[model samples]
Target: MKIDAAVCSSARLARDRRFDGRFFTAVKTTGIFCRPICPARPPLERNVTYFATAAEAANAGFRPCLRCRPDSAPGSPAWGLVSTTVQRALKLMRGEREPQSVERLAERLGVSSRYLRRLFAEHLGVSPLAVWQTERALFAFRLLRDTHLPIADIAYESGFNSLRRFNGVFKQIYQRTPSEVRREGHSSRVDVRAATPVRLYLDYRPPLDWQPLLAFLGARALTGVEQVEGEVYSRSFAVDTGDLVRYRGVMRVYNDAERNRLVVEIFGQEGGTGLYLLNQRLRRLFDLDTDIEEIQAILKEDTLLSSQLRENPGLRLPGAWDPFEYALRAILGQQISVAAASTIAGRLVTRYGESFVDDSGTEWFLFPQAEQLAEADFSDLGVTRTRAKTLREFVAATLDGRVNFAEQSLEDWCTQVTSLPGIGDWTAQYIAMRGLSMPDAFPASDLGILQALGSEGEKAKPKEALARAEQWRPWRAYGAILLWQSLKSGEQK
Candidate 1:
């Protein structure tokens, strides 16, 4: 993550949004840190210091800038490319109830606290606890500026245990009282009422191909569970508690093109915990945190893929909202068309999914759980007997804990999944690509990829296609997405 000073300086001077999350700048003279895309006056080169993360700048005793709000900047791409332990830790930190201590966090990652701190220091230039505190502070800063929530509520919502601690931390970081900071820049505040949806911006690197991604999701969206209309992508979800309780809600996310960021509005829940978790889910679902430039650098080296890459530079490999649900959809879609699978999925939901009604008068359903789907009859869902057997086995395995979506490495998950009935290399790889968020999980046997890579009028064998795709190592999934889009775009011509 060591960025060249001259290059960082140039990005800062130009106020480049492209480099927004790649790094942060701290001014020694002003004692303030800002995003690379900050709009305020640029500091002198001698007074400027670059940091790979906001946590690092904060660790160096620099307060966040009031105008730029480094906390709201797009997350660093380093999170995507880091080691598995760090990646898992990052995901866990986003949970509503995070681990109590660095030791606990390390225990979750199966590493000692010392080693965990070493890894964080190496990659993030800050301790894990510092990173967590910085996240809380910044999230609080965003709430203070955007909403009319009570300062006390904002404190607890931002992970502070008490009002005194929240106030002290705010002053320590921003050098101002929370109320004062809010009042200083409260002109654009929204009058947040008790029932209002919590709205926030999730920033990302530019050049997102929103249309193609929407089209892909729209075709496969299950009725009552998910919807994609025009620019908005909305879904109903449920989180099962340990004691047989479940919290249900609906989320809506869409692009604010003028702001160069995605706007996420969470309804049916008002706590910061739900808001934080939903934001993480949406970021993953949209693949917003991917380093497209790094992927494109590898992909463009392939002469065969160069043209497709040029045509859709911003194409992203979409991830799943719920990995289990998506894995079931993948099974249902084994060899069928997307539309056919979606229709059957809708029927399956109607038969077994839990129902809920939103405030907007739209009826919604949560995707069925493994326990419910295991014994359910799929005969009426428009699937063949063999496909039905496959799904039943899949559900049974999931219920029996033979198939786990979490706590398993990507390689192990792929191996275990391929062992199931009706699941093959292609389906397993597809699951890994979307469900497990493996950037390199390329399903070379996919028809779209084979069709896109054929020679003249001859289709390539799966083995040959896989061999040819070796050049796209570590980013073959991105190449697969671009290739798939090429076929879809070609069909419209």
Candidate 2:
């Protein structure tokens, strides 16, 4: 995770978007850290320093640049590329109520607090607490600038215990009170409107293949729970923000190709934790944090993937909104076509999911809960006995915490789920790919891949497909995306 000075300087000087979230350039004289794509003139090499994360820069006493907005620069690619322990810790930190103490956080990560601190310091150059504080402060900063949400509401949503604490932290980090900063921003910029239809953008690396990614999700979108209309993907979500209080809302996501960012519009008013959770889920849904250049560089070495990589740049693995819902879809998809699976999933949702209406009067349903699905009768859903049994077992495991998706390695989760009835290597690997966001989880036994890589009138064996996939290590999930996209172009024949 060490930053190469010369490489970072070059990227900064050139304003490379590829390195946008990978590193930040902090100006010694200005006491500000900016994203690599920041538009400000580059500073002297002597006055510049690089940081792996905004928290690290903030830890070094540098405030975020007002113009560049580092918080919206996409997540650090290191989260997906670093150690499993760091990955799990980061996943936990991104949750609504993160572990307040390093001891508690370490316990959840199954590592000693000292070792966990070492990992954070080594990779992020900051303590776990510093990272969490910076995250909360930056999110509050964003809400203050971008939306007209009341200051008190902003404080609560940003994880502050009281107005006093929120103001203290804001002043401590940015050297100004929240109201003062907002006033200065307002005076400096044009008139701003209210926070209606609260709009935000999630940045991603370039060359995004929006058409195929949308098509993939659009084709399989379930009714009464999710929809993909043309370029936008919309869904209803329910989050338990502690105390058994369920915050429900609808989110609309679509690509903003001109800006190289995904535009997310939340059509309901749920406070800061809801925004935080929605952001995490949306990032997972679009796989926005992926380093496409790195993935493609490795994947292009494979002969079969080379042509596809050239044909489709910036291809990404589409992720699920919720792991449990995705697992259910995968269970329904076992030995069935994607179309058939979608139909059955839609019916299952309509029957078991909760009904609600958004601010726009769009009737939506929350995807069925684990306990609800576990005890529900699935026989009438037209699913075979084996598939129904597999789904029930999956839900039962989820409800009882047997099939956990929290902070576990992809291999562990895959193995844990595959141990259930009717879930095999393909289903497990597919779940790992989309459910756990494991970039290397390739389903070599998939018939589409077999046909895509095979010769005329013959299909490749699973062993052969896996052997051929070795070169695609660490990015086989994206390779799977390429193969599936090729199927749309009639190249699988």
Predicted model with the maximum lDDT? 2
- In terms of lDDT, model 1 sits at 0.81
Tens-place lDDT per residue, model 1, 38-71, is: 8898999999999887888888999999888887
| TM-score of model 2 (CA atoms) | 0.95
The TM-score measured for candidate 1 stands at 0.92
- The ten-residue window of minimal lDDT in model 2 covers 186-195
Clashing pairs in 2: 157-272
Instruction: List the candidate 2 regions with Cα displacement exceeding 4 Å.
Output: 186-194, 270-273, 488-493
The 0-to-1 C-alpha lDDT of every candidate, in the order given, reads 0.81, 0.82
Residues 219-306 of candidate 2: C-alpha lDDT, one tens digit per residue? 8888878888888888888877666878787878888888889988876655534676677778888888888888878988877788
lDDT of 2 at 375: 75
